[model samples]
Target: MPIVKNLVTQMSGQIQVESQLGKGTTFTVELPFQSAEQEEHPCGGTLDNPVSLEGKHILLAEDNAVNMEIATEFLTMNGMKVTQAWDGQEAVECFATSLPYTFDAILMDMQMPKLDGCTAARQIRALSRSDAATVPIIAVTANAFAEDMAATTAAGMDAHISKPIDFAALCCTLGRLIGKSSKN
Candidate 1:
């Protein structure tokens, strides 16, 4: 429920939920419409050429199954390999156990059931591995405030991405962080 609401709001839409005892709930979503004149300035421009993340391996830590699937599909479409971690603890464990430099980057979520993105990042940074201090850990979260970014930075994350995820921005961030060549 929270994930759905967050994604909707992030896309500049409103969602309302109504429920009654012994009855199913109904969710109403209101999204802004752009007029023909305004259509020229669509939020994010359409991709004439999509960025390729070939040969990149990403560790994605997300609690929501739907969100995880969406992200994984997007990344995969861009030619990147994605590894899933359901929570912060699993992320930490995955990073700790993997070989040094195994993953090119990590996409972390701030809120999770066990541990948290911040704690996981700290733990990964603290690991005794060659890439522990250098691997780019990017926060993919719903926390979009200045303090949230500061917190992610303090936890050793290299970048912060707010949800709902913007594919173009995500591609650019990943490219900049990992020094990938532009596809177009």
Candidate 2:
């Protein structure tokens, strides 16, 4: 049996692929990011339909510029508004100063200058203010190990995501927490 993979372009265009036994295929698509007719669908599943990222605000804490760009691009592509912090210290500041409970989620990078993800998460958890205390802090890092997950959990992170972030998994996690479907 053959498998089909759909590569969505910057615009609403998509490249479709079909692969079969003992055979190979290739395709390229060049398209601009253009506004298209909105399609509505039931939420909570995979991101298969266009969704409104209008009011959603995500705080992204990463030390690397390249990583920040990549993450910002991905999150923004899916209709998310993002605030980027160059390191964990800045992340902490952002969380501490911003209106409590204003952010939808915090994507914390494990390896960051100054405060680091675990420390930042702990500080956020330790907040005396109740609104800021329970905000979902999700670990986003390249470190994928049992110990790493355990450590993050101990630090009060609600979930952990291995870097080169998986869109589907992120969507699923957000859905479970925020009660919204990515396929909106």
Candidate 3:
């Protein structure tokens, strides 16, 4: 598909396709070789330690019980406090009622009953509180398409994280978005 092709091209790679009547098509992708150092140090130098989320408070807005529990447990294991919201409307309400700067970030599900993620995000952003505009609202959903990402941005979300969540990536993203560096 276009996504795979685009990824290959972005890596300064090439792709070829071959097909024959009554036979399955074949596709090949080739990219410039990378050394171990290049692979490890993607930025071409030593990488800083990933920021830690210890003691940070997070608002987790997810509808599914299993997902909420998993995400909550992971966050707690990483020393972050989690406040759960079952749907988008509840998420908006929770943010509205909370004290300013009480949350380090919000993980919002894109689909929910009562109100969708986009509407809730806009509502949160429209709040009159000081933290309304500043708080990071991250869309956490199954919609991983490029257009879906764009939709989250358009809806005033600060970030987008697709599910099933990548716990390490989630931590790093949260750290980047709202954490204070351990070096601080």
Going through the candidates in order, what is the number of backbone clashes in each?
0, 2, 0
Write down the TM-score for model 1. 0.73
Residue 66 of model 2: what lDDT? Answer: 71
Ranking by TM-score: 1, 3, 2
Model 2 regions lying over 4 Å from their true place: 1-54, 180-184
Task: State the local distance difference test value for candidate 1.
Answer: 0.86
Model 2 root-mean-square deviation: 8.6
Model 3 weakest 10-residue run by lDDT:
40-49
Tens digits of per-residue lDDT, candidate 1, 112-136, equal 9898999999999999878888888
TM-score, model 3 to reference: 0.71
Better of 1 and 2 by TM-score: 1
Better of 2 and 3 by lDDT: 3
Q: How does each model score on TM-score? A: 0.73, 0.70, 0.71
Alpha-carbon deviation at 125 in model 2, angstroms: 0.9
Question: Alpha-carbon error at 151 in model 1, in Å?
Answer: 0.3
